[model samples]
Target: MTLKPLADRVVVKMVESEETTKSGIVLPGSAKEKPQMAEVIAVGPGTVVDGKEVKMEVKVGDKVIISKYAGTEVKFDGQEYTILKQSDILAIVE
Candidate 1:
């Protein structure tokens, strides 16, 4: 199964968090923070939302930074994904 976003929403998969710090110190799983970076899995067509035209600026396979607490989490086939509005995306990583 696949996730298809509607309106100006987007579906993203979280990038794995690093287990080691810059100093090469291995941190425990309990010390890891939620990853803010993600890879775009699916994109929604640009649509008018809240009386304003929302255009999709990102596409599938693009890496992006999103608000830390944004999006709804869903689990499918034992994999987790986030579904959120395009506006929730902060920037597209080049």
Candidate 2:
């Protein structure tokens, strides 16, 4: 399925967290944490600021790191998606 983000909205698919610990330890399914990183799937044209349309700095396919507590949770077609404003985006991965 394809989706188009509208004005000031961005679509991100969360990156999966590792199931195993770095210290050569394994974690149970219940002990794992949700990954805070994601790749940008889609973004709105731009945000309106002071009656002007300001183009966004990020684009599709950019790996991004966002705040762990940002954005609104949403679901579509059995898949989870997060809708966030440009301000909520913390950094763009190189």
For each candidate, what is the lDDT? 0.91, 0.81
**lDDT string, candidate 1, 3-46, tens digits:** 77999999999987657779999886557888899999999988
Question: What stretches of model 1 exceed 4 Å from their correct place?
Answer: 19-30
Best by TM-score: 1
Listed in order, each prediction's TM-score against the native is 0.84, 0.76
Poorly placed runs, candidate 2 (over 4 Å): 19-30, 51-53
lDDT of 2: 0.81
| Poorest lDDT segment (10 consecutive residues) of candidate 2 | 26-35
What's the true lDDT of residue 70 in model 2?
A: 83
Which residue pairs clash in candidate 2? none
Error of 1 at 32 (Å): 1.5
Report the error of model 2 at residue 40, Å: 0.9
